[model samples]
Target: MSKPKENIFDFKLFKRLFEYIKPYKLVFYSLIVLVILLAAFSAATPYLTKYAIDNSIITREEKDFLFYIVMMLGILVVSTVFQLLFIYYATWLGQNLVVDVRIKLFNHLLRFKMKYYDNSSVGVLITRAVTDMERIADIFGQGLFMIVRDLLTMAVVFGVMIYLNLKLSLIVFAMLPLLLYATRLFQKYMKKAFEEVRTEVSNLNSFVQERLTGMKILQLFTRENIEYDNFKAINERHKKGWLKTVWYNSIFFPIAELSASITIGLVAWYGGLNVVLNEGGVSQGDLVAFIMFIPMLFRPLRQIADKFNTLQMGMVAATRVFKVIDTTSQIDDHGTYIAENFEGAISFDKVYFNYVEDETVLKGISFDVEAGETIAIVGATGAGKSTIINLLSRFYEIKSGMITVDGIDIKDVTLASLRTQIAVVLQDVFLFADTIMNNITLNHPEITEAQVYQAAKDIGIHDFIMSLPNGYQYNVKERGVMLSSGQRQLISFLRAYVTNPSILVLDEATSSVDSYSEQLIQNATDKITKGRTSIVIAHRLATIQKADQIIVMDAGEIVEKGTHDELLKKENGYYKNLYEVQFLKEHVA
Candidate 1:
């Protein structure tokens, strides 16, 4: 069981939540007035009933009774109108505020350094952005202003009770200390229960999302029973957390009702006895009104306790959200430089990088590629082959090094300008659930259907694409699940090609595919790489044989750098050994 956040009374987080309401300050102030109006009208009804009882019924004055009845009816109509307005605007304000908050959170998320995501759960982040935001909306909708309305109603009721009869009012309020004590205890336990529930909700979401995503692997390995048992345990914990809150409610509400019943009984007994005895202290009208006022007083207390829990829950959700917003894990994009004519000359000078401390992935590496040159990086797994591409794209900053493009330090240029000039096609191609044309263009208005068609034609995949049902309008489905691995890679090639990037990176783009798909990708690659600065990372040495230069890596350093033929001629060279092993495996297969 994860321990919940200890401090829910974070003023800073609460202040940030309030900042979203600034735009609707007018609505908020109007709500406060409406709340007061609601309370005033509600509190007036019992008094009007008492006046009719005393001035008309008890005194046998029928003429005045009709006027009081009409007045009471009018108050009820007005109260209902105010209640409707309060709910509509409160909910409206809450919904609009959440839209702003969620958007702000999403924008912050988009700018975060990729390392933040590397260490965070996708499900947890989704909870923060989606479900948790709904809870925060409750802060405005049902928590703050609603509580104020209830409290004001209770306050007015209290004043009316005393104004009618002091002794009976005192008797009614005598039970308050017990109810307040119970409410205090309920709040303490409920806060802990709610925290546990929230934590379990996030855990369950993450568990379900991950399981669904990996369902194929789970079934392949015959782990269905094991995973089911795990889910059952998690779900059981979730149920237990909610049940704790239920148990606390079961105890607290009954105590509150019992206290209210006792207070009402006291008011009835004391006020009725005085009236029957003709003591001249309590009147018939006053006794009638006390009955109505007692519930009015006690109901708000009960609801306040409940709404306080809502307010606390929202505070907890806000704390989590603001924590993410407050995080400084973002790449510095303060550089004002933007290249007007990017030439794609690349350089890495003594780069050193580590995903984890004391465990370097790239060690003092250096390399250079001229404009329009095609360079291939080859090595075994964990030879820092992919790290080089990541650094080049500024996905992860190098620990101590300088990477430059066209003689300008890449760090000194805006990320948009720097990345706009480069396009990467990863081995694992990800396509959105959309039409093939939209996936190819990625919604870039500049890349039209004609451009996509021509790019596909040049890559020799035009026929393959046109063969599909609906052709360019065909929906690929989520993550391109409807397409084969090779077909998805081909789409990615077209996507990269249409961008007309100054530098093109194909990171092991042909590593996993059939021979036929590889041939298609090779053709596409040849066309795209023509006269473009290209960096090809490949496990298959055959793909890079015609490269202008080949850099062989071992561990973290560049062990060999030369043209394919020059490196192959060196005795016992890293490139020569890699080539012979792969060549033998190909022929043997």
Candidate 2:
């Protein structure tokens, strides 16, 4: 079994949580006052009952008995009204506060760099955003109210008890220390149990999310039975955690009830002795009122125990959420330079990079491409072709040296403005569940319908789209699952073209399509690259045969550079070998 985790009290995290609630300070204050009023009215009821019993019944003063009964009834009605209003506003404030916090958290998460997501799990983040916010809201809505009401009720009841009869009051107060000690012990165990439950829940949620996302892979591998066993094991672990919590809570409640019963018995026994010893030492009214107040005191104690459980859960959730918000991104964007236009002149000056410190993915690389020129990078799978493109886009900053665009260091340019001037289309195409027209115009929302159709026509997908039942208005399914891979690629191409970017990056853009669709994409690529700087990363030698310059890479270093024919002339070079291999494969096929 895994050892229990330690509770790390983060005062800063708690302060941040309170900041979210600061906007509703007035509402919180009103809620406190309403609770106080309700508690005061509840505490006064027993005193009124005592007055009626001692003066009206015992002394036979029946003159104002009806008025006293009416007054008590009126207090009950007023208390109920105030209590309802208090709960309504308190709950409303909590829900709204949660909404504000969730929105802020989501927006902040969006601004985080890709490295953050690489280290965190989707299930954990989702749980924090949805489940944790709800738990915090429950604390504010119900838990806080319970705490305030219970404390107020206890204070008033104890004060009234002391004023009514000092000796009996002291006897009642003496039991309080025992109650507090028991509660302290219970809380220690309860916090541990609740933390275990929370961890189990997070694990279960991760299991479900992983399985759902990879359901296809599981079915393809015929691992249904194996996966089912794994799920069962996880569920059983969660069940055990919950059972432990239940067992602890079960013990807690019984001990609390027993202690309360003993205190009540002591009060009745000692008060009875005092009454018998002196005829008017304590009246029947006083005895009845003391009995009523005993339950009120114990009731709040029970509520305090319950609220402690809720507070424990909220604390666990708060800790998880703050973990994400506290993470610092490696690549910080603080540039204020915004360029009106990019000429697309890119230069790499002795750039070095590595995803891990000990393993270098790219060596000291130096290259320069003029504006409006086309460059093709051909290399093996791990030859750092994609890394070059990622660096040019500033997705990953170089460890040493620098990259410049339009004669300015890339770091000096605003990320938004820099990326806006460049368009990228990867091998795997992703589309939203929206109309074809929307997908095409995604890069430039203000593009006209005629421009969208012309771009689609230029890309050779217009005829196929026109044949569809809904044409541009058709609703695509999630991730464009309804469309073929080639069709999705064509849509993505149209999206890139509509942006009219000054620089274009195509990373194996035509690798997934058939020969026919490849021809259309090649034609579209030619038109898109006509007046823009283009970087094409491809394994197909034929795709970049007409490029102005072609660079061949090996082991993170460029080994060859020239036009297609010039590289083919160097028979012993890496480019020549790759071209011959691809030629043989095509001929055999």
Candidate 3:
């Protein structure tokens, strides 16, 4: 188990966490009031018992004894009510505060650029959003409020003990330094232990999430045993992390109990001697109350140490969550362009881009497409074909170039308006684990059920969808695995069709589907591309033969451009060569 690199207990970190709690200040203030009342009642209990012993029982005063006993019972009842109120309200405050923080963090996550997700782990982020948030809630619900209550209890107990007998109180004070030292050690080591536990849990989450997502591959390749062994190792690390906290507890608790026992013993011995000597008039009642106060004082010290660990864990979690919320690397959607009636004329001027610095994927590439034009971009793998679509959609920022729609700089347009204007059907269709209808509409109220059904009908996928047990209401399950690849593609087409965007992008959309789905897609494509500006990134030479213009790219630069028939006339042209390899080879075989 490793320690965190950041400062373990930062006041600045805690101050930031409290901002989330500020909204519920009323509840917290009320909880604090209850805490103080509870402490006060507790302090009075020992005194009431002391008075009963001395002035009532020992003196054979029945009336005074009954009154004192009744008073103690009444105080206990009131204190319990306060404790219940504090617990419920404190928990409520914690839940509300965490809910707000989680919502804010998730909203912030949505704004981050695609590249951030590409480089980050989903499992780790989930842990931060879900598990880490819970840890922070523990600080409010169980940790900080408890700490405050304990400290106040200890303070009240100390004061009451001193008032009862100053000599016994002084003797009790002798053990304070040692207890404090033990608590300090417990907190320091436990902080590191909890940090390690969180880290290992995150690692385990990542490992399990990734493996389960790809479980099919593991079984298919007969690597289940290997993966299980790996999982066991990671799980062991998680277990070891928690065990370290247990180890710290084992060492600290016994020591704490021993110190507490010694305190009580010393108070008894010293108070007994004082009573025998009649020093400071230490009566049996006073000695009993002071002895009771010993446990009350020591209990808080132990509890405070435990609560501090929770506070520490929460601070660590908050730091992680803040790290995500604090991220500034997001797509700059500062563009002022609002497309009321967009003429989808797209142009790329001397564009250059690279996912990594000094490694250009698209180099000074320039192109033009008129509104309502069907331009097919064809290239071998890594020829920057899909990169063109990615840049046009503004998924990633271009290094140095101007991509424009209707001659308005894309960077000058708001992302929502720009994205709403374009519908992209990716090669690998992703369906949420939701009803088919919801997947198509994506909960867009404007696109109703009638519109979706009509769109599916128009795409010739209506009958196929209706054949399913639940029709369009069926849940696709994770990644749409329940449906065939072809069915998923049809759903995607329906999704795009209902959007009715000015620009439609189909990037290898029909490549992975079967012949039947391809034919259906071709028919849907013809209808969808009738007037919309469509960018078709395809490797299937047959699908794009009717394209108004075909741009052939090689090594990040356009190698050829013309109609299918015209490009075929050039004997050694890149497009001609590709068409022969893809189409002619199949016919020859």
Candidate 4:
């Protein structure tokens, strides 16, 4: 079951977010100083206007008018220069911060145990790493710096307003409480709405990603209408999420506009009374500057309220990204062994394992294969044949008991060392959409082109590759779709061989290949497994007939173990019956 799933204003989330910027502290601090200077410059503009009106424009002093004009133009030039610097540096800082964050989050994911990915969706993980990460970038690029700039601008503007005329400034500020309250309401509602929006985004992505990957099944089974209906429902939920945000925007902005308008109207009405009676000796310039200050102060308050949405979205995204970053379910790679050289001897002692509790898959099963020996595992579906292979490779943890290689406890060896010493070729071979050479060597810096060519030649696939349009450079397309199944398996064999691992695991590798490819694979198998330990899991009894030892499993237990002829000699043996049922039919056909 999924854990059921906030209040706004999470300082903890903000604290974690700001930590990313810590690496670029010099740029960040410089931005803050630039913003403070920018704010001071903006506050000076209205005062410049006031002086022009009082000392030059209205009084008809030509020299004073010229001086004020030149001074105001200089301020504008300075403000424009500062604004450009602000934009360039702010975006630079945001980009750097996110690059670091994305790398950090991705590196964190590399350490997570397989079970986390098994239970988590690729789409959700993509959302956290890519989409949510972008939102976090926006926080720095557009939200935090601008929020600081606006706040500082508002402070400086208000101070200037009070300095010009305190009575009118107080009246303008009276409208603040109403606007602040409206903004508070907006934040509360938007947090829940945006949360819904983000949740729906994950769900939608997961559904689409799954369907796209499995389009063949959907088309073959004719699930278009059913899946489309499911998609429609999810999409509607996403629509509703955004609509809730829109509804809040509709309600909140008007209240903010009304509050701002009321302050402007109050200044006009009350300032007229003062000027009429000459009550406070308020000059024409003072009243004019005071009116300009009203919006300068209040407009920022409104814009900051708007910018708060960006901040909130960022916080929401940061919370999700950090959740994955903070995950503690990890494979410990602290063992000292560094794969000095693997002898390939393997042992499974009283091993018990299960994917879920109370549903054991490998039930007290144990086995051993000496160095340079070949072991074959044959079993019915769900009898834990593949599960055993997964344990040997340490893909999944066993519930109980121990597995060892070369008399060393596998658990006490570093995962990199343990895995590097072994290679696996599964029945369903996967190849990247790249050149055959790349697929073979996987671009390992140490493996040279000559080494890859020699491995291919030794495996007898060199002539076949050379026959292609570009030989080894031919693009296999997605998952090697351009090649036959046998060709792909041959590639996997070459890949495994190039690594020269001590243990080679072929999990039903030859199951679905054509006869020609099977011949090629058999030849590759013989060449690679000459001096290495190999584990072959297959349904084809003939393939394992020459194995040094064969382990037949049934319902998670080893039912029989012996040489091929020895096991078949038993009249009522499980292997004998299985061979007659599966392998005999193939020969008869």
Model 4 global lDDT (CA atoms, 0 to 1): 0.87
Off by over 4 Å in 2: 1-12, 273-279, 435-450, 466-469
Prediction RMSDs, each to the true structure: 2.3, 2.9, 2.2, 2.5
lDDT of 3 by residue, 401-438 (tens): 89999999999989888888899999999999999999
- Which residues of candidate 4, in runs, are more than 4 Å off? 1-7
Q: Report every candidate's CA lDDT.
A: 0.89, 0.82, 0.89, 0.87
Name the weakest run of 10 consecutive residues (lDDT summed) in model 2. 5-14
Residue 301 CA error for candidate 4 (Å)? 1.3
Off by over 4 Å in 1: 1-10, 587-589
Task: Identify the superior model by TM-score, candidate 1 or candidate 2.
Answer: 1
lDDT of 2: 0.82
Q: Estimate candidate 1's alpha-carbon lDDT, on a 0 to 1 scale.
A: 0.89
**Candidate scoring better on lDDT of 3 and 4:** 3
- Ranking under lDDT, best-scoring first? 3, 1, 4, 2
Model 1 lDDT per residue over 1-589, tens place: 9998555356777687778889999998999999999988877988988999999998989889999989988988888888999999998888899999899999999988888999998888999999889989998898888889998998899888888888988998789899989988888888889889889999999999999988899999999999999999999999999999999999999999999999888888888898889988888889888888888888999998889888878877887888888898888887689966578899999999999889999999999999989999989899999999988888888899899999899889899888888999999899999999999998988888898989888888899988999999999999999999989999998899999999999999997788898988888788878888999998665667878999989899999999989998999988888878885577467
Pairs of residues at least 3 apart in sequence or in different chains that clash in candidate 4: none
* Model 4 CA lDDT for position 514: 88
Give per-candidate clash totals: 0, 0, 0, 0
